[model samples]
Target: MKFFIKLCIVGLYSIPFAYLSVQTDYEADSKTNYIIMSLIIGVLSYFCGLIRADLPLIFGNIISFSVSYFCNSIAMLDKKRADFFTPINSVEQIVLITVMSIVIQVIFYKLARRFAKGYINIIESNNIEKEKRV
Candidate 1:
């Protein structure tokens, strides 16, 4: 049960991480922004994982950088149909992407945490009911 709960929490963090990392348009001027955003996400996920002392959480958070970079490269080619290494030529683009990443990260983290809590509550309630019946 604990393992399952841990998996759920980690998944909650990762699924969106993969999606958004791929979706971001990293140009030269905005590459720094991407790196900074990645670092922030990495830190948030790392702490969230540490909440349970789970192995998967620790490793997943650690590997978040490579995961995001891989997804970004793949998405650049497959989804956006753009070249893999487009540099951000403008400061305006950097600011826009950075702000957008921050907002999206905040929203996703809140939702994932809420979902994990709700899931644990349901499982715990079920276990209590079973114990009472026994």
Candidate 2:
């Protein structure tokens, strides 16, 4: 339940960036691609709670990067290849990609830190209570 709320909030937060990634004429496809990316990030991050707090932002981004990059590299969706902020040359493309990656990391970290803190605490406390009874 809490994870659902967090996922919804993260989805809403990512929408603007998704819209911004559409550099080509296929506006709908581009938006869908990024929305999918956001979902991948959110779901993976939510599961990361089993491990540690920041693991979602850390490991989730690392794992999701390849999938997102593969989706970006193909010409089928956005020709821009995940480049944000209107980067022109290859160097600019690299720079913008890096920038977008950093932005995503920050956003994911912020959302998880805010929404996940209480939920993990609740779970831990409940587990502690159950252990006391046993």
Candidate 3:
């Protein structure tokens, strides 16, 4: 439940950036890309909790870069546009992607903490009930 909520929050946070990425390119539909990217980021962040340090950054960057590069390449090929090379455009693209990644991390961390607490409570209660039964 906590993870699901966190996933929802992270997924929601990513939507704007994904939409902006697609809108700036104006070739393919941004909404579809937004949903796909949000899901990818959310799922990755959720699983990232299971790993140790440095992995999240590496995984996030790899996923973000791959998606950005792929979308930019597709836009270039399909629309014959050169908007991605501009300094401001490049900055915006990086900023949005980075923001999306960070938001996912924050949401995941909060959710994981809440989940741990809930699990502890359940365990304690189970132990108490077992003691009473015995």
Candidate of highest lDDT: 3
Residue-wise lDDT of candidate 2 within 2-98, one digit each (tens)? 6665454444333333223433324444446555644654554544443344533444344334443444445434445434334353334434544
**Best of the two (2, 3) by lDDT:** 3
Model 3 TM-score on a 0 to 1 scale = 0.52
TM-scores for all candidates? 0.38, 0.38, 0.52
User: 9-127 in candidate 3: lDDT tens per residue?
Assistant: 44444344443555554556344665666666665555545332234345445555656555555555543355534655544565676677678766875676567668789999999
Q: Residues 1-134, candidate 1, lDDT per residue (tens digit)?
A: 87776676566445434335334533332345456556665555444533533465545443543455555545545533454435652233334544565555556556667777887999999999999999
Which sections of candidate 2 miss by over 4 Å?
Answer: 1-32, 53-87, 124-134
Cα-based lDDT at residue 85, candidate 3: 46
TM-score of 1: 0.38
- Give candidate 3's whole-model lDDT: 0.56
